[model samples]
Target chain A: MEMTVLIGLDAASYILTLLLVCIGLVIIFGMMNVVNLAHGEFFLLGAYTVVLLQQYALPFAVILLIAFVVVALVGLVIEELVIRRIYHRFLDTILATWGISLALKQLVIVLFGPGSQQAVAPFAEPVAMFGITYSSYRLFVMGMAILITAATFFILFRTRVGLTARGVIANRQMAACLGVNTRRVDRLTFAFGSGLAGLAGAIMAPLMSVDPQMGVGFLVPAFLSVLVGGTASPLGALWGAGIIGGSNSVVAAIWTPVVAQIAVFSIAIVVIRLWPGGVTGKRKR
Target chain B: MSGYSRQLTVLFWAALIASPLFLDGWNLGLLSQLMIYGIFALSLAFIWGQGGLLCFGQSLFFGLGAYAMALTTKDMIPGIPATTLTGLGLAVILPAVVAGLLGLALFKGRGLYGAYFGIVTLSAAVIAERLAINWSYIGGFNGLLDIPPLRVGWGSWQTELYDPLPFFFVVLVAALGIYLLLLRLERSAFGTVLRGIRDNETRATFLGFETAEYKAAAFAVSGAIAGLAGALFAVQFAFVSPAILGFALATEVLIWVAIGGKTVLLAAFIGAVAVKSVENVLSDTLGQYWLLVLGLLFVVAVVLMPRGLLAPFLQLPLPRALRLSGSKEE
Candidate 1:
């Protein structure tokens, strides 16, 4: 009974983490049609924010907020300088973002040196459920994931910014004609996406070893989730995160972690082969 | 080719051929590595420039070739002999088959849009790298080492190319051969058809051409050439690792081809050599920050000059013999 409960919790945690890492991508890729290859680097930047500032002994929540704001500001700067000019050119944007990714990674290495850094978990005590013990930090991560995902959903669907962003996403020219500042919408959308990625990094920093190359590990899976979700709706990201993350966790229960990873990738490949537009299909306009 | 471009090509080849006469052992070895990378860049140029496909997983083929060569030469396979020739053949053939099958799968139906295709390839390369790390049979994460040097001649009468000069000549011959063959193909009717499909796939299909098959063929050929480069690299470096077959190298090659000018084969070739050469100098002076400079250059080039820095200067008109008569299209 304990093993089963643990397994269920593990799978759930995996799904939540995957969702947190990829929700930002859904906003950026789905809404703007911009493939920000530097997204993973943005994530790493958040992780670094936690790593570097924690020495001051600040509260974790405050640091987390700082990570989000700092990364969003960085995103805003990048948007003005690089992404804004090439929004219409898909291939060019990819290459340019890839360049940015490289530059950010190297910058991290220069600043932090080549060694991996660790973050102390804020909630260290183990919580018991169904006669099994689990790290409270893990539980916190799960709650945070749910909370942020819900907040993002509300912000994208219920708020005015969300409405304008949706309007721009649906049809940029139409939105522009309706007195919406489409350019501002694009900039904010990108920064919000990037900010979410940074938040994810900060949340995850305590759970894993943090390094300059940490982003690369998460990049493929996150991109795969978004790719499988398509650029149609935020719901596409939810469905993608659930399916890919769910399958990976279940596979990890039965097999070696490496095999589980391979299975997840193979499943993604097969899925893509069958449904090239992704699991959600194209947007309904 | 135009008179100016022809003269430029001749001068370039002449300089490379005579380089070994003046250079010492160390420089010759460096040049050999550059030539190998040139071949790798050329493969990407063929697919991206000619077939209009930007494959983000190109190193998958190159790494496949390296491992294939290393395994074969190390006698890791059951029946196959560990000969240089066998390694070379399998290196070329394996990647070609993989690329052909993948191209077929990807290019079928409406086909993946450019960015979508690139992401899928990127995923494929990362998956391959993970598998390599997990599979202990192929040395797991440490990768294969102690691969033998290239040897020529039959049974008891073989000679190994341990010296830099002889190895340089061998690489030169191979690079020149691949370049000429690719150049010939570029000027052929099939090449024109491929370019047409590239300019507009729907129009080419409407004009009664099998666009998928053409793309698959181009991918296969590119993969084969990349495998050749990988095999040569394995022999030269005497090692093969998962990093060579993964996303990092894939991105590195993209930067090289993008900087050099993917449209013209020679430009891409020179791009690889020049970039690698500059990296050697800059990495020493600027330390690791050199990557930032390169990244800035890459972003600027892609945003402002998609044709690449050298492409505009080197994109000469096709030779009269190679040109499709009355087809004035670029």
Candidate 2:
């Protein structure tokens, strides 16, 4: 019974982390029709925020909030400067964003001198769950993931801006005809997506060493989830993340992490082969 | 080819032939490496610029070829002779077979196109890299080392390429041979059909061509050429690592091909040499920050000049019969 509970928690945490890391990419790709290959770099920037603020005596919550804002502002700048110019040109946008990713990685190396930084997890105590001891911080992260997902769902379905953003994503010309201010919507949506990725990085900073190459490790799995989840649907993100992350956690429990990674990748390929439209079979306009 | 393009090709070849006369051994060795990379870039240019298949994980084939050469030369594979000839042959064949299989899987039914194709290829590369890291029999994360140099003739009469000059000439011959073969193919009827599929796949299918077979063939041919380059690289560098199979090198190849102007073969070749040469010079001066400048340049190039910065000056106009834009039924 304890083993089952442990596996369940592990799977839950995996799903949440994957969802948090990938939601921003899903939004950026689905809504704006941009690849944003530098999504990982934004996550790195968020992690960097925590590393840089280690000297300051502040609560982890304040640090995370600052990281989110910083990443959002950076995303805004990138969107305005680079992404805005190549909106519909998909291939060019990919190459351009890739260039941004490379630049950001090297920039970090230049500033931090190629060494990894560390941070302490905010909640260090052990919590009893189903008669098993677990890291309280991980449990807190899982709760935060649920809260964030609920908040995103509410904002996306119940807000005026969300409606406009959805309208723009569905049909840009039609949305513009309805006076939705499509440009502003695009900008804000991109920023919001980047901010979410940043928050994920901040949340994860304590768990792993923060380095320039750290983003690439997260990027592959996140990308796999986005592809599997169907880029066009928000709900698809959850479904995809659940399938991939849950499977990975279960496999990791049974075998080595490396083998689990390979298994996930193989499964992703098989999924793409069998179901080209991803799990949701939804297409973007 | 047009008269101007013919002249440009001739001039370029002449410059390469004469370069060794003035360049030091160190620079000549670097130039030889560039030529090998040029071959790699040319394969990508053929598939991407002409065949319309944006392969994001081309380094997978290159790395595979390198490993094949290293293993075969080291006599690690049982029952196979460790001759240079066998190693090179295996290099080309292995990647070709792998590519053919992958291409069939990818393009057979409900084929992956454009960005989906690129993403899938990228995933394949990542998986290959990870697998290489874990598979300890082939040296694992550290990779194979001290791969033997290429040799000619047999037994007592064998001649080894210990000096950079001999290797440079060999690479030159290989590059020129591949260039000429690809140029001929560019003008062939098969090339016209490939371009047709690239421009509009459905339309090509309507014209009664087996589009998938042609795509797979192009992919296999491209993989074979890239494999040859990899074999040469391994012999020259005497090292092979998982890094060669991964995303970073793949992206670098894409940038080189893009910057060189993928539409033109020679341009892509030169682009590889130029970008690598620039990297060698700039990385030394700027340290890690050079990547920042390179990134900015890449971004600017992609956004402002999608056709490539060097393409206009280098791309030769095809003969009227072979022109890709005016696709009339032959």
Candidate 3:
């Protein structure tokens, strides 16, 4: 009974973390047709931010906010400079961002050396949950994932930016003609989406040693979740994350992580092949 | 074609043929390896330039080719011949078959295109890399080594090509053969349909052509060429590792094609050779900063010269018979 409970919690935490990682990718790809291959780097930057903040002994909230802001600004600058120049040029955008991803990863290596850094978790303790003791940090991550997803949902639906997004998404020309700063909208959407990725990194950094190559590890799973879930809506992203993360966690529990990785990748590819529209059932536009 | 370009082409081939005179054995071997990469780059150029498919996981096929050669020559796979010729044949055929099958999955029904297609290929390459690392039968992380070099003739008359002179000429001939083959296709009627599908798939579909089959054919041919290059690499390096078929190599090949000129086959080939030469020169001095420099150069190359840095100087005019822009079949 205890093992089953523990496994269920592990599965839920993984699914939520995946959802957090994927929301930004889904939003950026769905809102503006720009595929930011460097989205992984944004997450890396966030994780490193937590490592930097470790010396200062700052509160976890401050560290998360700073990571988000710093990476969001980086995203904004990148969008204005590289991404803005190549709108609707799909291949060019992918290349430019991939170039950025490489450069940023190398830059981190140059700065921090090739070794992984450790960050101390603030809530490193055991908590009793459903009559089973679990790592509190894991539970905290689960909460943060939920809170961030909810916050993102509220921002998109209840805020002005969401309204502007809907307007622009419905008709870019119409929105631009009606005094909407469509370019700024693109800028903010990219920044916010990147900020979410950064937040994911900061929140999850304590679980794993932060490294220059950490981004590539998470990058594929986030991509798979977004691809399998269809980049149509946040709900789709959550659904995709659940399927991916649930299957992966369950498989990892049974087999080795290497096998789980292989299984999930094969499943994702087969899923994409059989259901070209993804599990969300939304056809590619 | 311009008079100057044809002259340049003749001069270039002449210089390549006579390179064994001025260059030593070491430099000749190095140049031969770079030429092999040029062949690999040409495969990408054909698929991306002609078929409008930017296969980010092209190294997957290249790696498969290398393994095919390695396993066959090592006599690891039961019931297969352990000769270089058999290795080379399997190297080409295996990747072609895998590419053909993958094309069936990716290019069917709604079909993945643009970023979706690129991302999927990237994931597939990553997955293959992981599997290669874990599969103990293939040497796992340590990789396979000590593969035999190219041997010619029937049974007892075979002479191993351990020296650089004979190998250099062989690589040169192979590169030239693939180049002419691709150029011939580029000038043929099939090339027209390919360019048409690349520019606008929907229009080609409306015109009653099976774009999927055309794309799959191009992919398989590209895979075959890439596999051939991989076989050459395995023979030259005498080792095969998971790194050969992963993200690192895929990115390197992309940079080569991007810097060379995606549309022009010769320019793309030069892109690989030029980049490899630059790396050979700079890696000693720059050390770890080489990747940073390369990454920045790739970004600049993509931004300022999307057609490739070498494309403009090398864009020879098409044969008059194949030119389609003047109220004809372009």
Candidate 4:
């Protein structure tokens, strides 16, 4: 029974990490019209930030906050300098983002060398819950992800900026006609999305090895989640992530890790085919 | 066709056929690889330029072709020819079948814009590469080796196409055959309907043309040609790997087609050679930064030549001495 609990906890930690990343992707691709293929790179950037701060023996709280702000600023720069000009051209955006991803990956390689870097947990404690042991770090990551999601939902649904963002999403031309400042909304939304990804990366840094190609591993799952959840709903993104994350975890527990990844994508393909509008409600044109 | 235009086509074919003689072995090999890529680009142009399907996972079909060829030779499957020609046939057929099935699911979305189309295909490529890497029988990461070369006859005096010269001729002939077929298809009434569907799918659907069917057919044909190119490529390289179906390779091929200008099939060939030749030079000099240069080139091409490199050539003004617009003169 104890062994089973240990296995389950391990699997849950992995799933929760994936869920957080997917939730961030839902906000980026589902809300904004930007198809950010380089989103995983942002996650990498956040992890690198945490690593860098740790090198200087910075506090974990400070490092996490800095990671969020740094990644958000990077997102803003990308939006203003690159994504702004290529909003309407989807194919061009895909190619450009892929280019950015390549550049970021290479830059990481040049800075950190080609090997995976180890990250140390700032806090050393195993939290005991119901006679089961859990890493405090993993629980913190899971809790923070949930908190961020809640905060994002509140800001998106209950705030003025959130309303303007919805207005822009509904119809960019109409939103501009209504004097909603669609450009600012787009910039802010993109930054918010990148910040969320940064947070995920910073938290995940301790659990996984930080490497140049780490982004590629996360990219497929995040994309599958966004695509399956329907690129139009945050709630749907969470649900999609849950389904994918849970299934992948269960499969990995029963079978090999490789099979789990394959199973998730296979399921995603079937789901997308059956429901072209996605698992969530279709977006209104 | 105009007499001069026909002559130019003949000259182009002649030059391609004789290129191996003038170029060194390594250059000839590179040229052969470029021609295979050219064929793949031309296949993409048919779907993208004519049918308006922005397929990003063309590497899927290319890989299918290569794997089919590789498997047939490596395993010595019965009923499938061990020869390169039979490998080529299987390669083309499998991808066509897969594309036809995939198109049914993809074409259902009402507004399958370029971005979504690209993402979906890219996802497929990712899945394919994963499967390729995991499945060791298909050579996994090390790839399949010792693929036999093409043979022509049963007995003595039979030709074994091992050297660059014979392989070059084979690719040239196959490419020319496909090009002629594409030319004919482009002029057909079916081609016009495809263009009509591209311009306005709703209108074409209203006209009872079954736009989805046309798109699927075009995609299948394109996949088949890409498969042919892949089979030829496998033979040239004498190995097959997951890299054949990588996103980078797919994107590079698409970039070549886009840069060449999708308006004309010939431009696909020109673009493939030009970009690849440039890549060869850049990769030799810049090492890892070659992709950065290629990426910048992609952006610049998108901004300046929206119609692609072929646009300037098509838009060139006629000389005052030969200004007969309506006449079909050479």
Which 10-residue span in candidate 4 chain A carries the lowest summed lDDT? Answer: A276-285
Off by over 4 Å in 4: A2-11, A130-132, A283-285, B1-15, B108-114, B303-305, B314-330
Candidate 3: residue pairs that collide: none
lDDT of 1 by residue, B1-330 (tens): 244776788789999999988999999999999999999999999999988899999999999999999999999988999899999999999999999999998887766757878888988998899989888899999999999999999879999889999999999999999999998898898888899998988899999999999999999999999999999999999999899989999999999999988889998999999999999999999998999889989988888888888876677687686564777636
**What is the TM-score of each candidate's chain B when compared with the real chain B?**
0.97, 0.96, 0.96, 0.88
Can you write out model 4's per-residue Cα lDDT over B246-296, one digit (the tens) per residue?
Answer: 776787788888788775677777788888998888788887677666765
- Score every model by TM-score: 0.96, 0.96, 0.97, 0.90
Give, for candidate 4 chain B, the lowest lDDT window spanning 10 residues. Answer: B313-322
- The lDDT per prediction is 0.90, 0.88, 0.89, 0.79
Q: Which one is best on TM-score?
A: 3
Model 2 chain B weakest lDDT span, ten residues long: B321-330
Stretches of model 1 off by over 4 angstroms after superposition: A283-285, B1-3, B319-330
Per-residue alpha-carbon lDDT of model 1 for A27-138, expressed as tens digits? 8888888888999999999999999889999999999999999999999999999999998887778899999999999999988997899988887999888899999999
Candidate 3 share of real interface contacts: 0.75
Residue-level lDDT for A75 in candidate 1 = 94
Clashes of each: 2, 0, 0, 0
Name the better of 1 and 3 by DockQ.
Answer: 3
Show where candidate 2 strays beyond 4 Å.
A283-285, B1-4, B323-330
- Inter-residue clash pairs, candidate 2: none
- Candidates 3 and 4: which is better by lDDT? 3
Tell me which of candidates 3 and 4 scores higher on DockQ.
3
Model 3 local distance difference test score: 0.89
